[model samples]
Target chain A: MHKNIESQLLKLIPPQSKVLDLGSGNGEFLEKLSKKNISCHGIEIDTKKIIISLAKGVSVTQKDIDKGLKEFCGLGFDFVVMANSIQCLRRPLEALNNIFEIANECAVTIPNFGYWKIRLKLLNGKMPVSSSLPAKWYETKNIHLCTIKDFEDLCADNNITIKKRVYLDADLNPLKSWFTLNSNFFASEAIYHLEKK
Target chain B: MKIQQNSFEYKESFHLLNGGSIPGFELVYETYGELNPNKNNAVLVCHAFSGSHRAAGVDKETDKPGWWNEFIGPNKAIDTNKYFVVSPNNLGSCYGSTGPATLNPATKKPFGKDFPLLDVYDWVASQNLLRKSLDIQSWEMVLGGSLGGMQALEWSISFPENIKKAGIIAATSLISSQNIALNQVARDIIRKDINFEDGDYLIANKKPRDGLRVARMLGHITYLSESNFKNRFGRKLQDINNKIDSSINFEVENYLRYQGEKFSEYFDANSYILLTKIMDSFNPAGRYNDNLVDALRHCKAKLLILSFDDDWLFPTEYSKELHFAAIMAGINSSFIELSGNNGHDSFLYANEEYVSAISNFLNHA
Candidate 1:
């Protein structure tokens, strides 16, 4: 699930960039970035996740995402990335604002709740269940789930410029050709590289 | 394994930060592993407020290991096998060192309240003198937590050319007002005792046991958080048949009482007051025009700062400030807040992650 997203993130990050990752689970991504000579740190809430991250020699601060990155001052990092965890935040917009304040650039991935399968499920009078979001409604951690369009709108409203965007299917394969194109509602997931406008 | 305690007497008399002077003094310390020929592998580990110079190994009298035995063995985090380790009890501590409890040579009486006031700066200077006496020119690193951590920081600043790295765990550049207030109340408890006799209780051969117990009781409370206290004791009664109106009803009360009693047996009341006052006045930036970032700019050692999530006394926010200041000073630094529910004392516990981080940082040196 992370291999392709990591490649996309690698493309966006410059060499030797200092990075702060939000919700960096297990720290495998940061470890990979460190191999590329990038200084990496993380913020995670779960104790087990933090232990796993620390075991990999990644410095992670244990703090709730809802509390925001009040510890870090403005422009502390070269890049800030929150992969596959933005939807779980109680305040995604505020988190994004904090991310921008701490770093010059950021990347965020969102599971497209507006995918065609979800639309089909809604038409059939049922909630969607896809590989990217498999949990039942009540048990899901995606408290603030949003579509690609909704995320783009949030970025525009918050004066964040979208530098790059990519659409992927359920298996994380890029939607490069014709089977269905030109609409975010048809993709399973979306990744956006953002910067302050 | 057995560890031998050693002492060094500074017969020349020393000066203190508060302009007080001592005619002569002694420092008790311990060493582990062999000092390499080049003398570059020496690492000094400072102790917290209540800690001693015995960083590792078992004591003959108590049949117990040192406070940081897990972190400083042959193959442990600090790795004595690879680095020479030196730990010294601070000047104002009651542990085997010259302090208020020690007799004054001139008057032939205990110094007690007459013991000169010392701060982090004096402690750093004294440690530096110990370093020189041992024929060591510079250290590979200086590591500590809590009050000890403050001294390590001051070491880097006070002796900028002597240390290469510093591992500061659960520490802050300055003590918060809330923490100072807590220390104040502990002092009040100690002073209000009728037996205190203006810090000269030893003359009458009477000890202020009750007052010292109350002070230690509250001081222990500040070391932990409500979350940790509740999670550990959780309204559990000490005795099932005991009434709630009793002096000690809950398990936590029993725990605190036991700890306080044990503390009063080993620690001197005057030493506690002096140490807490030093802690209360700790500010590494005091000499740098009160600008923390500017003060940090003078530090030549690389820094590794760690904090625990549940540490309310020196919370993660304080570590963040230290990190920010280090970054601003353009020093190499890393800050990590560990996940633990044990509050400020989490630094005392040995965890795989915490150990690895320290090992990794020291290895990089």
Candidate 2:
């Protein structure tokens, strides 16, 4: 995830709207939402994270995303945020299906595998391993990693509408005009705001 | 601080929702800490199936600490120093309260099987009497785990204005058929015991020890997780030197036998049946045409639901259902699943994080 993850998400959600944060890590993002008067709930997997969230007076449920969000169906949340979480799931497709069933809109961030730097690394005939993409192929938690084009294809095929998409460089800085022109080939990561079509 | 056992007698006949009435009933209870002048700093503790009014402090005669001593004491999770704690034995319990084991005024004999069945509503009504007797306007928090948790939720639903906050731990608002089926096996075993005599064993100066023992053993199975059992007593045997073909039993068997033996010795079979029946009959949503959102619509208390990851009997899913209803019904609510290996009985165990989580909710929420 980007260093400005909360700041980036904080901009998308309006005050007092009900939001469900998927994979709320350590509850810092939820705390930020609470300050803005947003009625926010979180689904976190780690016990320590849940405890921290509880202490903050934020209602967070401990659940495994890989198990799917069937219980959260019909919750009617305004927005759902999945910052650097979808790729780690065993079945990202099923996760998406359940998420759309619950929330009207979603904010998702993913590391772009089609970045020009990653393409250059592939030319060396080695699986890329850098500060940006640190894990080796064998031990990477990103089992369902995908490029921006692939994700867009998934959304288009599933009747989902991408309202907004932002591309960032390796340093998490938003790409400017020329870089945005070829985002799939140059951007290091991408954030998208999606709605069910 | 030291605690003492007390009794509150309602002289008038206490009527049950089922049209059965008791001429007069007594509730044995205990109080810890001094009630403030305003009486707003009061906390009520509801006990589970076999829990007692002795939820805190040690008994002077036996020198044994109460059941929930880990969570309720001078400076425990439920700090008696800061809040007045009231724990009462429900009416239909064998624990000093008026139940089947008590002599009936009409026949001058134990009520036995004739003792009318009681439910969560009956207990809440009787407890409301006790609350009035104490002159407390509203409880700061009413909380419990398992059957006790069900009673706590009943408080919020039935007396919406009297309880400021309710913490439901390791319990469900409605008992599933799966849970009822589990209780049925135990019920059948107890009813068929030769010495049970149709719950009239007290008149015969005999106890349904075998039947009650088997029931408790079966109950012990659901109160724990398979992982907990495995971790506690895996392949260990009572007599390790004995060959596998011999009559040696595993440590788990020995533990269950010990638990059953103790439970049957002190707990009454008739009370056991009555309490389980109460548990099965607890569905507040039934009155609202099975809509939990409508059932909780009038509740004013902030609700906190806590579940354990390993509590298969009432898992985190059950708590999530409650959370869904609470939110939809427009109530301030929270649901937390504590990570633990202790299963349904995790609330009774003294873990730092678990205790802090609850105390934080009680103090802040």
Best by lDDT: 2
The lDDT of model 1 is 0.84
Question: Which pairs of residues collide in model 2?
Answer: none
Can you give the lDDT of residue B48 in candidate 2?
Answer: 90
TM-score of 1: 0.79
Q: Write the per-residue lDDT of candidate 2 for residues B1-365, one digit (tens) a residue.
A: 74767999999988888787998899999998878898888899999989999998887798988889999987898898888999999988988999989999999999988899887988999999999999999998999999999888889988998998898999999988999998888888999999999889999999999999999999999999999999999988776654332454787777788789889999999988888888888887877898888999978888878898899988887878888888777676777788778888887887877888777767864
TM-score of chain A of 2: 0.92
- lDDT of all predictions: 0.84, 0.85
Best by DockQ, which number?
A: 2
Question: Lowest-scoring 10 consecutive residues by lDDT in candidate 1 chain B?
Answer: B240-249
Best by TM-score: 2
When only chain A is evaluated, what TM-score does every model earn?
Answer: 0.94, 0.92
lDDT of 1 by residue, A1-197 (tens): 37998998888987778888888887888888877878777777775665556446556666688987866655357799899999999989999988877887888889998888888888999777778888888888888988778888988888899998888886777776773465466678888899995
